[model samples]
Target chain A: MTSLGGDRSIGRLLASLALAVGGMGAGAVWAPSASAKPPAPAAFCQTYPDSKSCTTGFAECATCHTTAPARNAFGAQLSERLAPGTPRPLSDQAFVSALPSALKMIEGLDADEDGFSNLAEIRAGTRLASAESFPKVMACAPDQASKSGDGRWNVCGYDPNYAFRKISLDFCGRSPNRAEAEAFRKIKGEAAQKAALGEALDRCLVSKYWLGSNGVVWNLANAKIRPAFVIKSGANPGPVPLGDYDDDYNLFTWAHSGDRDVRDVLKAQYFVRRVSDDPVKLEIIPEEEVKKRGRATAQPVPADKRAGLVTTRWFAASNTMFTAIPRTTAAQAYRAYLGWDIAKMQGLLPVSDEPHDYDRKGVGAPECAVCHTTLDPLTYPFTRYNGIGGGYTYDDDRLKAYIRGDGPNVVNAPKSGIILGKPVKDLVEWADVAANSDPFAMNVVRDYWKVIVGREPEVQDEEEFSRLWRGLKDPARYNYRVERMLHDLVLTTAYGRP
Target chain B: MTRTAFIPALALVAAMFAAGCSSLPSAGSEPAQVASIDPKVKFKDGDRYLGDLARALNMPRETVCKELGRYDCFSDAFRIVLGGVEAPNLTVHTPLEEAALTAPIALDRAALHVCTSRVRMDREDPANAVLYRASASGRPDKAWMETTSNELYGVLLNRDPTKAERARLVGFYKDVATEQGKPNPDAASDWVTLSCFALASSLESIFY
Candidate 1:
């Protein structure tokens, strides 16, 4: 968020000054001002790097602003308590430096009035801003867990019997038979039972039902690829038949299945081809040979410039669709891959001097400036890629054609852009930084967590959820293999209990 | 005719369909007119229910149930209501978060349809029957009802039905006999079909 502090505009500095001396408008409820300085998230994460919200390298916007600029309960308290007498609208440098002390002042306060102190909630990885969310270490105390009435289900902790049935259906696409469940229950010990469950999961992980076309992995890509049959060109062709999104789904399923590194979905330079459906095998179409598929849906981005799904022909065709400045393309990538939605004012990290009214979109006004500042810089790298009717290739001249319609100023939009505050020259570098970051791993693991658990992780499940996502980032633990992560996932108390 | 003989829950579900079917265009007559939006069910678990039920019953998935014995149950007539997708054509990428208003009607419509179909097939080939083992004449006995309840639970839920569960199924069979006012041969087929329908639409069956 320090990038937002770099704004050199005199009008904004005056507004920050006016908001500061006016008591932040924090003392009284106020309408959310758009694009409050983006540097606050960075400073918040820096102070509490171990915080659960910062596990992905950025604190949630909910931590401070409700819709940002509009402070939530804790944020309101933080605003009043921050650097008590310092001029309101602390400069980026001043705000970053004073935040730790402001946080300390309110540690004892129950901001949400949930009966838990702010410090306790933060340390426990629960949301301090919401009364409905708090730590639950005692929710399933060891002595109260695992013991049962039916011997068929455990009420409070991981129950092998429950998980066996759940895993069979989730991965294998059908429930286990009575004989199989009976055999699983009869295993002599917990370790042996888990081993048997793991073996069963190992077998299911590769089943045609999990990895095949229209299977689990394939369906996960539906939102990411947003496949539409009208423009679909491959096996099940649509009437218009534009660039096929089967290519996008193929790369997604390939990168996520088996021992493959999950990061390849965003960082790989090669294409994955589905060679068979009956057995569900996907082989890499080496970058050198990517041209053989030479159909209308073929990869048009040269190998060295490719960055997995972000650079796909279908991704460009669907999202960019001939915009001179491709904010929609960047926003879709950020949301689809990083789990951050920009439309809802999420993941806003305003870059300084951005939204320079690029393509003359009239986004420099305060209300429009709030989001476009972060969005426009993000869109810059995408300007080199042609969309939809532009032959689906990357070139520096792609923006020149739009200049005729967007005005002569459109040609001046730069290629360099900032991602999460780190500057990158092009999409490949942007993707590389994004793929290797903590948030990338968190988002990847969350996909499986939601599908398997049938819900998003709750406050009570935070500890196990935190451990599992962190494990995905550790080299020796899961090593980025989604299959290995699923083995642990099936064993979690959250998954197995009830 | 079989719809009128099931448990009260299934019967209530059946009554809704009784009204719904009367409004539908008859087969081989003309295409029905569109009334509103149709969002498709595109996810795996969303479409899994009917297919898994067919597998458990050991019938060809498509033949398990059909609307008017023509359109397949899962894919055609009930596709939109049952969470099937109508994508690209309508841009519905996500499946329904909760079951539709007609979900219960569709559940019994498919379950009772399949159960009745299975009993008919078993009657035609008693020795090779999957459910019912072999056709019996007259009302189903307590032991046979208990066995059928366990079989349904075993195939659908992967565990044996509890004693209370088995007792409920047997009691439902006696209720079916009483509903007829006197001993009747069709009550036996009706009992078997209702027993299967109750388990097929149970909370456990629909969820897991």
Candidate 2:
């Protein structure tokens, strides 16, 4: 007969997505007129240095180009104001210098016509180009504040008591039993209670429900790995298991747990084996042992060729499949590990005069060229890594081996490619560039943010989200340990409040 | 306004955004106060919900909720609807972003299953029973329902029911008595079973 108490919003749950909220930043030294000039993304941040979109150091490509070369309403407006009468394809310097004025010129206009002006949208961290992606107006003010049960709850701020209940359920995977709940309520000082929450997290972080086979952290890899049980090789091997994804899961779990380095998920040269499931223990397996013990479906990418989860046999087999240009493979690695989705027009760093369409996939057409310019070159390094037929191994002849079906033009695929507007010699360098990138830190932090906070960082959450990710990459704070970062995260006003 | 603006907070220290990757969102114009109402991050997933029930009932998890007495509800029947992932087999890498419509129905079925299963076990051996402390052989008194509510609430919610909640359960007992017409010997058992269902499937029981 008791009332069931819960809100009715169906928001992101259990951290299963890689939502493409892309912003780009790359190494210095790319000249003003470098390849694919008019870095609209970069110039955007320079113009609106305090724009919410600039928090991560760049704006999403969607802010200007619908799919690069095709400007959105905001970009179209900016185009009209940018260096008027200066011929098409203005120099990067001209565009960069003129960007502020162009942005200011259009500030009064409602680019998306969502009522909010372009400047307001940019400041609100809403999409200036998309009508649906606008900031929510404050509907309720503090004077009209909703009342709490006992009047003791900080209705306007982080409530440690509420946060303790949340942390217990989220991390420990259950509500505290009556005795434990009562004991938490009995803690005297707020600092002591907050300290108790940390201790509880320490205990729960090691629980089986968190690190076990189907545990919360393990499932966080589901969207990234996209495991298919039918073709799975290890643990619950399918009928025709080709390769095991558990290795991929093990490496992911290891990278995110304990005193581990999260960068290892992208930069690890060694494979991790889940040594124990209960009180989960994962250790790096030496290359020699992995090689000698290799079954046909064993982790096929040799230690020297491995790039953490990106180079896992299952990752290559599932995403790359069979293709002359393994654009899907490269895109998945970028989307999954780096949190950029080219499909969503995110993380675009267009290489100039690109998408040679070497395999003749018709990507040279203007409609396709915008993203392909960035995507095709981004895919070049992945082309050298074979798909299903090649056991996902690195092969100099991978392109040549596919020429029979894809034609000899496939062999023209480049071994070097571009990532974040910077050139990389190969996928190994590509992973390294991505792993150390600011986006990688932001993306990793965003993953946990979404998991614990139960939603994407809203305009209100930007400051907290920014601090958490920044601290994650800061050696002085967390030293890149996700566990350490989480300590600061649970303390964030966003996570602790509501 | 921005909900945390009124709170004592860490000063916003913007990381120079040390470059080398595509990113987004910088400190934009402080638009306005973000509403005090943050989105509700509620709803326990199936694993946690079912696990909580199993732990509270002092029953083996396998006996908690079996669809058709065979399949595990969390792993099978209500798996996806209740927020358990079945990846690599179904490609459902993540749980549904929101609780599915059938989620509440699945939750009810799972909760009822565990509650009834516990009642059945306790009825078979009342001397060693964890619930139904008093015999459910006849019409229950108000005092008995109060004790039952506390036990049920403590077992599932880990806290005693409020006075209002106790009053509601007691009111429901009268309705159960009327449905019996005659003083059915099974009225007390039926009342206990129904009361357990109400508490086990309550929203507070399901969501965090």
Candidate 3:
């Protein structure tokens, strides 16, 4: 598996260098001002020949014209820097002459070489700059706006008139008002574009195999939530990156393959056996004999890594490597076994726990709430989606109804799902928890802001919650609120904390 | 000549234009006559006094031409009727007054039945009325257009309160068509109603 794609670490280095160098010129050039003079307001009005009804108002003109030029400039720069061989620059006068043409040009520039254009990257704000980058882009679009076509871009399921898609999708129709849309676009570019595409790809991969639909949907709530069922059932499951998809199955498949060169089964054994405190009472199974009896039963880890296979039945089990090793003192044994100090191993425990299906037996282990309680409750209001990437599985009837406008009402509707012992509901309720009961969402925000701004926010930053709420409430303030939050967090004393 | 002579003339022209003539205007006429008419209860074969009035008033061919969202009000017709109406002084005169100036001979009350289309057609022409074209274009000088469109809107209101378009056009003319800086109630209703219709249409286009 390691030899499948040899280390291309050099590619990552070059890309990271390009981003750092490009930052100096790119950031300064495309920055749009809320107060800037709008371009071509009167020109748009002139389309109506007989009546100047659409013309003669500066405010009205300002609505559409504010960002056209800026968007054009952004496109121009992107074209020149990313794909010089392309005939047109994004911000060229020719590009501006017809918005559709400009979008077409941007769509053609596959900066990531993942069969998707940078325009898709910009829209989803993912790093699909290369084949490796494809995973991030795939993880982002999933069910909504999934790309399909032999050689061209054609998205299904996403509304063409969706505000975000309006500028990036069609480009031919009337453009979004600059005041409202530009800021959001800039914010997206800044956050997603900063990372090397490969790194972004890697993160996307990690998210897919581990986080699954619940995680992806949570991430997508910041952009838009199309349907709760989309995530819940693992329906279309939009554009998750190929690398993440690949990584997720590769690790699992390797463990079960019975190949000695591969160390995956050993890895699982290390995770399970090392976490036990009382090894003497635990059961341990060897992989060699288990593979020999593979057809009849689940396999077990090799005896070398297993601590007490003969004395106790408590052990780990995998579909290939080991399924489970149940012992009377399994819980106690699990706590005592650790290669590293218990305190240092706590962080690793979050990902290391074997997924338990509470449904399989009458008694079920604690689930998402164990780690996500604080995060889930706090961040609930910020978004209202779960079971993101592969969680949504829709039947034929639901699909037909959705297209016909007779589908389930996913937006602002009550939801019921068991994450732990309790059934969590809507975004508002989620927000309530985040604001009051949960601190993880805020911590995530804090961490994200710190990374963005190069510093942490102070206790006084609590007041920013209201400010952020107010700004987000006014759709016009999207770009500003995000930037201000970044600026405040970075420039403050609190953000600098480790 | 007796008033009956005009009946044949009205019928002949209605037939020529393929307009409904029988049910609309009464064949017998007295030059200064005024009769209350129901807007609803479609006069399937009613007289299309519009063409007669258009011809009588010499309304421009362009004004009578149809376009998407173009022929909304009397002022819109005024533009086509009056050649090169100024934008600044659009509200200076009413649709009737502007029509009076453009086609003085058509002002006789006997021609009122035929005048509706003429006025509407004139409003459609950019040349005839000042405020009209601007108003339709969503321009700043829409006030005058609002005023005239409103007045014509008034005519529609009075003729048939329950007419199919009465409520819709009335709502838009009142709420949306009028100019921003200044508001005129008389024409405001119609102007706003039309403007609202335009807005609603735009929203529908984007969403649906």
Top model number, lDDT = 2
Model 3 CAPRI quality: incorrect
In candidate 2, what are the lDDT values of residues A1-498, reduced to their tens digit?
Answer: 111112211111101111112222333312222324346656777778786666545565566766556788888898888899998777777878888887888999999888888887777667777877766643334453444322434445667877888888888798888788788889989789889989988888888888888888998898898888788876768888777888888889888999988998888988888888886888888878887755755666667777788887888888887888988888888888777777765655555677799888898886677578778888888887776888778888888887778888889888888787678898888888888876788788888877888876665666676788778888889878998888878888777765
Q: Model 1's lDDT to the true fold?
A: 0.71
TM-score for candidate 1, residues paired by index: 0.81
Q: Of the candidates numbered 1 and 2, which has the greater DockQ value?
A: 2
Candidates' chain B TM-scores in the order shown = 0.74, 0.77, 0.23
Candidate 1, which segments miss by more than 4 Å at Cα? A1-59, A71-138, A141-150, A286-289, A292-295, B1-9, B12-46, B77-87, B133-139
Query: For model 3, what is the error of residue A212's alpha carbon versus the real structure, in angstroms, after optimal superposition?
Result: 37
Interface RMSD of each: 16.3, 7.9, 30.6
- Displacement of residue A336 (Cα, Å) in model 2 is 0.5
Model 3 C-alpha lDDT per residue in residues A33-73, reported as the tens digit of each score: 12322222223223322211221221121122222333333
Residues B26-124, candidate 1, lDDT per residue (tens digit)? 222333322211111123333577777778878887677788879887677766677655445555555566768987778767877877788788878
**What's the candidate order when arranged by decreasing DockQ?**
2, 1, 3
Each prediction's DockQ against the real complex? 0.17, 0.25, 0.00
Candidate 2 lDDT by residue in tens digits, B1-208: 1223211110110111111001211112211223335545577888888888888888888768899889999887888998888887788887788778888778867876787788878889888677676735554677777888788778877877656566656666654453324544555665666667776766567765
Extract clashing residue pairs from model 1: A1-A38, A1-A39, A20-A88, B40-B84, B40-B85, B40-B86, B41-B83, B41-B84, B41-B85
Candidate 2 DockQ, CA atoms: 0.25
Error (Å) of candidate 2 at residue A195 is: 1.8
Error of 2 at A497 (Å): 1.4
Scored by CA lDDT, what does every candidate get? Answer: 0.71, 0.72, 0.27
Q: How many angstroms is residue A122 displaced in model 2 relative to the true structure, after the best TM-score fit?
A: 4.3
